[model samples]
Target: PGPGAYGLPTTIGYEKHDNRKQRMPQYSFGIRTNVSGKDAGPGPGAYQVDKLTRYGKGGGLEYTMAPLTKFKDKGFGPGPGAHDVHLKPMFKGTEAPAYSMAARHNFNFKKCGPGPSAYMYDINNVKQAAPKYSMGIQTKVLGKNNSPGPAAYGAGDLNLRLNRAPEYS
Candidate 1:
């Protein structure tokens, strides 16, 4: 098949003018290469490096109820340089100990329903009430020898009969 049958150019036919112009072709190069390596210069600081370190001198990010008192500071019980042998630690305040306080204080226990104590029955003094009638296996004579009736026979008293043909020797 010719190029006309497939929609492609077999030869340049539209450039038939004799006054065609020519231009110089210029080339530029951009060679790219990736060389992976660690940075020789000092890099950025690690996460949270500027923050307070453990057991640092300056007051750090930690929160405290009160500043630490030095041994020479005053105020532990009017003693020499605030150094007094107290029974309780500083965390325990002047309030009474928990054991000395009244338990379940101001907490009203709601009466949900009638408990066993509210019932008429007394657990410690329980008494068995007598039944209205007696209950037991009756031993009265049903019939002779417990045969249900006098006409009913036991297995030892049964007599079964059988008829047989005369036997040949």
Candidate 2:
């Protein structure tokens, strides 16, 4: 009785009951004639960018200003001008070639294994472990009715912002 249950005697678990009655698929949905009424045109791997031509090797610096042949008659000098003069000692010869940890990536140094030990919380030495002060037993003395007075334990009274009576506008 289980193919499409066409045989009816199903009471073993009554079709595994989730409030059971669902058999409706004897097949009746065929009328879709390949559904395409209109909008799907661009298909040869469609990813269009019409005229965005950025094909490389073409940015700033084409620079033709050699018209300043030695400033073309020097009419612009207000101060330091021989091409701003540094006459050569900007960085000459301290012979710099020494950083070669065997020329770098040779990779062989990791053996330190046993780590985590230095934490010692209190073996008694910060001024002999300090903490002894003692001055706190006053229970409750402001204008002395000695507290526990108002709404003592379930505590709900003083909502004080100057005891709230001020909306007088």
The sequence of per-residue lDDT tens digits that candidate 2 reaches over residues 1-169 is: 5587574554344344344555443444676554584555667757544533477335444567567454345555565555644676545645434566565443433344544674556656665755677698756557756556666678455565447666686
Q: Model 1, 75-116: lDDT tens per residue?
A: 545766555557557566444445645554543345557666
lDDT of all predictions, in order shown? 0.54, 0.54
In candidate 1, what residue range of length 10 has the lowest lDDT sum? 9-18
Q: List the residue pairs that clash in candidate 1.
A: none
lDDT of candidate 1 at residue 163, scale 0 to 100? 52
State how far residue 138 of model 1 sits from its true place (Å).
21
